[model samples]
Target: MKIAFYGSSLLSSYWNGAATYYRGILGELARHGHEITFYEPDAFDRQQHRDIDPPDWCRSVVYPATEEAMRSVLAEAGAADIVVKANGVGVFDRELLEGVIAQARPGALKIFWDVDAAATLDEMRADPAHPVRAALPDLDMVLTYGGGPPVVDAYRAFGAKLCEPVYNALDPATHHPVAPDAAFTADLAFLGNRLPDREARVEEFFLRPAASLPERRFLIGGNGWDSKPMPGNVRHLGHVYTHQHNAFNCTPLAVLNVARDSMANVGFSPATRVFEAAGAAACLITDAWEGIEQFLTPDTEVLVARDGQDVADHLAALTPERARAIGQAALARVKAQHTYALRGVQVDALLRAQMKGANA
Candidate 1:
């Protein structure tokens, strides 16, 4: 099928998780014989940070991100078998959304792929300025990345024709265990950008643990952490690229996961790192969150940490052999169920359903 993916930067991860998401899904879709044209709005230096170019796999169409570009793209978008518009394109996205709805062919599928369902819903509920408030019923379908039970029901309640959660999964080719890089090797590591809402949880789940275990080396990766002071043992690497993630995962004795406020509140939302770390055979020590058990069984596949003491205890109790065993078990689970290929199959099913409904 000829698919047109309209989204934010395809290359930059700057404050957005959608970039990694697009690379994984669209890259795998290309491998599956689906033709893809990815549109990127030239808002940031996406071309500079691009890890993968528009090889034989995809046609990359970058627009000027203005109203004129929106008009031009909507004309071309009408021809696609499927067209996807996700959140945060840095353009006049409301007008762009209107344009797409106005210009799409009757048979061409239109989907809103949300990387931030929780935040989007919250914004809509809180204020009147939100663009998606009355536009819920306009899109053909709503697709999300990480919100679990609550998000699906809420989107349906908000008048969506269909709402599906395409949770983050590991790309098998990219995220397997590798030998440790000396710099990333650590007793424990946490990687995520700093946000005001997630700060307290980071303190409760990460910083406090570092303070408790002063002798152990802890690494932190992600941008915007420079202002935060840390214990002497903690190493802050500003941002680790997608290519560096496997070593970052495999080299840690146990990787720590702390969710942002929306994810924690919505429940069952696992970040891409969770799957990546699992695929790299890294034993995970994650902060206690609802719906976590659905992904991994506690005390066997993963260690659950509700507080700093729990995190410290997890580290103290680990033996290298036991850690490797847990990592392997987690990795096995991801390979069996959560690979990108599995996700693509689900997406293809949804698209077929939309096409079927369109015909009927």
Candidate 2:
């Protein structure tokens, strides 16, 4: 099938959480022999901050975020079998949806891909400025990257034609375990940007642990975390790149998972790091989220940490051999079930069904 993505910058993940999801999904779709045309608005310097070039399997279409440019792009997209207008693309994304749904030729499927459904819904619900408030009811389908059972039902209740949740999956081919580095390696490490709601959780669950473990080394990496005060044992490495994620995961004795407010509330959804860290054979110590057991078996596959004491227990209480065993188990799970290739199969089947319905 020929698919067109009207979404955020495929290349720049610098501060964008959806970067890995786009790369993984598109890369996997390409591997499955589908033609994908990724359309990104020229707004937001998305092209200039390109993190990855077109991987030889797909086409990249850059268009201005203006109405004129979008109308032309939507015409081209009219020829595609499927066109996706993902949330957070820019102001033009609102128009992208309208143009495709309005001008799309017969048999074309339009998808509202919400990479951050929890966040999007929160913004849309709280403020009048969210552009899609009126337009959302007409969407043919709504897809989310990471949200459990509740999110799908919620989207449907809000008048979506169809709702699906695409959980974050690992690309084992790209994110397998690697050798640990002494410099980057630490007893505990976390990789996430600073956000207001998440900062307090980070402080209680991650940094306080570092403070308590004065003798143990802890590392934190991500943008906006550089200015924050840290214990002497905690080292801040601002903004690790996508390519460098494996190294960051591999080197940690136990990688930390901190969810944003939305993720914590909507459970069973782990981010790229959970799978990436496990794929790298690193033991995981994460803040407790209600649905964690579905993804990782706590105490055996991952450690559930709620506070400084919990982090210390995971870091110090577990024997090195036991930690290794747990990490290995986590790795086995990702290898068996959580690769992006697995996700491709799910998405392809859904697209086929949706396409069939559209044609019928």
Q: Candidates' lDDT values, in order?
A: 0.83, 0.81
- Evaluated at residue 31, the lDDT of candidate 1 is 74
> lDDT by residue for model 2 over 120-189, one digit each (tens)?
7787778666655565665678889878778877777667788888888788877877777776878888
Name every residue pair that clashes in candidate 1: none
**Alpha-carbon TM-score of each model against the true structure:** 0.94, 0.93
Off by over 4 Å in 2: 42-49, 64-72, 127-130
**In lDDT terms, which candidate is top?**
1
Error of 1 at 9 (Å): 2.4
Q: How well does model 1 score by local distance difference test?
A: 0.83
Q: In lDDT terms, how accurate is model 2?
A: 0.81
